[model samples]
Target: MKKSSKDSVVTAAILLFNSKGYSGTSIRDIADAAKVNTATIAYYFGNKEGLLEYCFTYFFEQYINKMEASFATIEKGAAICLKRVVADLLHYQWENIQLASFVYREMSIDSQMVREIMATYSLKEKYYLQKIFERGFEWNEFRPHSIPYLIIQLKGLLMMPFMNTHYMREVLYVFPNEKFFEQKYLKDLYQWIDKTLCSDIQIKKEAIIK
Candidate 1:
């Protein structure tokens, strides 16, 4: 699909902002990369800050929708649902590593704009995750744990690798840019989730039988 001019600008802005900090990137740079006039950016996004918000919103919307879609046909149980959600999220983050890195970098700075974006979209993401956890608990698929802690741990698991992609690539010899690395990482992540979150219902049943 041909990207719309607005999308083109936002895509260019993500790459530029990821490479160069927000303050370091200029509207002209985005315009040149996107092959649009500077005025087009101002017209579409009003300003650089607005463009940043739009970029966050665009990518996050895509993430949330994909997550929701992953759950659509999942009637098996919370374990299956959680597994699919985690897998989809990991794949999405890998696919949009630049955006993930940019968001993580901005989050570390704690700028007013970043805080605002977090307050808005991140809350929604948290809520969705909370619902998933709630379902897991209700279905007895997960052991009882602090919901906030679980959320934090899950977010850390998902974001840490991508946020530290450079370090992983350079120091750890983990080439996240390669398909094989992501596949292996995702497989291990799934195993970790199962071990950490999955309730030992069979064990409990065996104990009851005894």
Candidate 2:
């Protein structure tokens, strides 16, 4: 990648945001971590809050783009749509645990920032899953209940492992690290979700095929 001031600031911001938080991290800290002068952060990002906003946008933009690509490839019917989306999502969080942690951390501390990010992306891909769920519901694809809650529960299944790292590292000794994203886990996870929600239903798994 070409070296640039914006790249430097973003890299530093993500690292510091992962280690420190939005409030805990400062412009000086990011500058120092990036080996640039504090003025560079100000020049590039305008200020600390500006830097935080940039970091939030940077993280979720990358996420949305990646998810868009994954969903584009494997979105069709309800069952396969959920499976593929969830599988790709699991692989993404497993690969970029920092991104997920950074998002969860920021959302935990300040929900407004998270809401802003979601709102920004929602018009595009953020709320697209709701469309998928609505389509599935119309087709009698999902369980006969709150489809939104089920969708969020599926997201929770992916988020819990990463957000609760300390507990996993200490107690469960089972971390959702690199190797966990392999075909074995993803296949089983997809299968479990498939059976859990699709077994009794008549809707065929045409999402991935389509």
Top-TM-score candidate index: 1
Compose the digit string of candidate 1's lDDT tens values, residues 15-37.
Answer: 99978879999999999999999
In candidate 1 the C-alpha lDDT for residue 163 amounts to 88
Error of 1 at 109 (Å): 3.0
User: How far does residue 160 in candidate 2 sit from its true spot (Å)?
Assistant: 1.6
Candidate 1 lDDT (Cα, whole model)? 0.81
Off by over 4 Å in 1: 1-4, 202-210
Please state the error at residue 112 of candidate 2 in Å: 3.9
The estimated TM-scores of all candidates read: 0.86, 0.79
Over the stretch 46-92, how does candidate 2's per-residue lDDT look in tens digits?
A: 89888878766876787677667656643456556666677777777
**Candidate 1 TM-score to native:** 0.86
Model 1, poorest ten-residue lDDT window?
A: 201-210
